[model samples]
Target: MSDLRRRALAGGKTVSRKARSKPESGLSSGNHTPNGSPGNSRAGSRANSRPGSRYASEDEYASESENDDIMTISTNSVSGEDDPGNTWAERLQDRVAELQDRKRSSVQGREATLGAYNHLLKHHFAQRQLDKSVAELMPILLRGIRNGSSDEERLRTLQAFTLTVLTCSPETIFEQALPILKAACQDADAENVKVEAIYALCIAVSYGGGSSTAAEETLDFFLEIIESDGQSVGAPDSGAVVTAALQAWAFVASHMEDLTVQSEAAIEAFIEQLDSSDPDVQTSAGVNIALLFEAAREYEEETGESFDMQYNQHRIMTRMAEIVRDSSKSVSKKGRRHLRSNFSSIVTSLERGKGPGYSTAGRAGPNPHTGGPRTDEQGEFREFGYRERIRIYNQFLLINTWSLHSRAELLKTLLGGGFGIHYLENPIVKDILGSADVEYIPNAKSRK
Candidate 1:
């Protein structure tokens, strides 16, 4: 074993050599129950003492049928049938039973316990034990993750228990795990540790951290990690770390409610990424930027902040329009298609609610400093739905129309100059270059 440990270190893999004896109760192996009863484990005892732990003292539902929403989603389909007799809770108890059967806390023994806890959480999640009663299981899982002696064990335990954290209420889970995950994302830890922590934080916030403030806090850390490599460009570790940070950003965007300044900053950063020399960085940035657009919500900033309605909408639109024009001539068809599709969705939706300083063609709008939904006759916040929907449809037409005009402008340049003028009199060419109109670019034919 000592030789194996040395060999593992030579290979640069994380290793552990901690030795532990089996407990008198055989808790190391999952075969034996903690209190000689399936659900009556040590964690269960601890749970009974914690506040708001439904799993400890209450069987909230009269039966599985009463578990209505929680029991609706099942893993039975994925796992296949033959186990209609057993519930998810029963299967989790079985894994815990195996955990108790382990005789030692060696690397192998620790792995066995991790596997057991992972399966337990999997079943628990599929069951959607909606009581938010994590107390019955949280401590034991936390112990495994925290007590992990090797980097390898820590990573595995972190992933598993952080998953268990999802079964917790967002507020509770964020309070307990956010600080630890954030600390781990810092420079003091190994690269792998930081990456795993970011991964876990992604899942936690995406699933349970409803607090936009938490999302805001988490977003700041990741953006720093991503921007750190600005000087080196394509340096190795930087690329991987930046990709992970982008993933975290996308997850947070999916869960956040308001992202006025944050979203714009992210948009600009991703736009910068579009210019990266590295193809991988470009690809990641492109996809994530699109995903960000798809996930974007209305801008909500309570604090007095500057937001120019025209600048915000027009800047993004112009960039996207440029990308579209480039795509028409560029070899990379995929990048063009992706930008066009996501851009259409965003450009159309962004202008629906015109806050202050919006040039909506004499249309009435809310105060720009306090842009929000308009209230109805009864004095409740309600949208002018008909007007808004009409505006959205018009915005779509405006974007496409401008794109056509751009095409016309480019065509005029081609037809009016050089040897290209020889084909100008062709029938199809003449029809497209009609004597200029209110919508065509340049306002008049440049045949001269």
Candidate 2:
């Protein structure tokens, strides 16, 4: 392992611009209970505790425990001078150029390069900045990923590339970044790099505004990885790579309007995945099952036709219930708890004939202004369909569809502390979340 990554995983200090703070990542599942939102109760407490629960990537440092440490860089690190008036674009251009000129052969120089990139990621970049700097950033980022002196540098560069695709004009960097990401996904020597590469590719396809055909093709690639049990990527069936592939597949699939054509075989695959011993792999597979059911429900409603999933619904729920109540000695307390909470929500969604978050206690229905699932005699709870809510600034962006929810979850994990800033300033982010139901709170404190 690279020295930097080894330090990070061992909970030692590594180059980070600021001491990481636990931002109130509004990514918490908002299932409403009788008392209040699910965040207040034990069953739903996991949502508040780990904001980046679904991310299998190495960048999820913020979700680590309080004891985990990172070395901080002072303001002068970027350029020996303090220039408060410089925009992010100017600073980024200067830093990227500095990194390019630095010798990777020198240990100090390489660490400095990683710190510079980390500092950029800590702050939000406005659309103006991204537009001005993306052209200059892409080639350097590509080189850092493919030929950095260490794995840590490559991983950080890949993360930066991900944020770029999410916030910048896709046309500017998509073509350049996609090919490199594809090659990285198949890299046999670096499993962490390959897992991260798979996720980065999914983000590129999702927000790139590519055609539906492109999205399907990318999803097919991920499915092959899962079906092959990571043999496609040279990893084991229960490895993190397969878990990442499963999540990535669901993240992309959530965006499609109708997945009926692929539902039966895809669902069967998911069911088989549930038998895997890895808790992460099991949870990911379970969520995909719920996602498929959610998609099937919507399709049937829209087309006024029967969307037969061809699987036994009762049998699936029984398996999900077993995981919820599981008390096996093999699984740790934390793992059991996570499994219970997630599957409990899934079970509720299935029983209620709603989507993933519906079964949780404290959720309100989709924002009333944005039309949602049909309202009926069951009151607002019944109206609570599948969607996730993101609390950013004073606005609540309600991602009222499973597809948008999947995209939002992944973006939240990638952006971390910068998510609210990007949502407020980046037009590309605005476009991806454009259809979300918006709720404005008059005087709420910002939750970035």
TM-score of each: 0.46, 0.73
lDDT of 2 by residue, 172-264 (tens): 455566778877777635676777788788888777555678778888888888888888767755367877887788887977877876677
The best candidate by TM-score is 2
Q: Where does the lowest 10-residue lDDT sum fall in candidate 1?
A: 44-53
**lDDT (CA) for every model shown?**
0.41, 0.59
Model 2 regions lying over 4 Å from their true place: 1-90, 100-111, 172-176, 359-389, 446-448
Local error of candidate 2 at residue 104 (angstroms): 7.8
Error of 1 at 371 (Å): 47
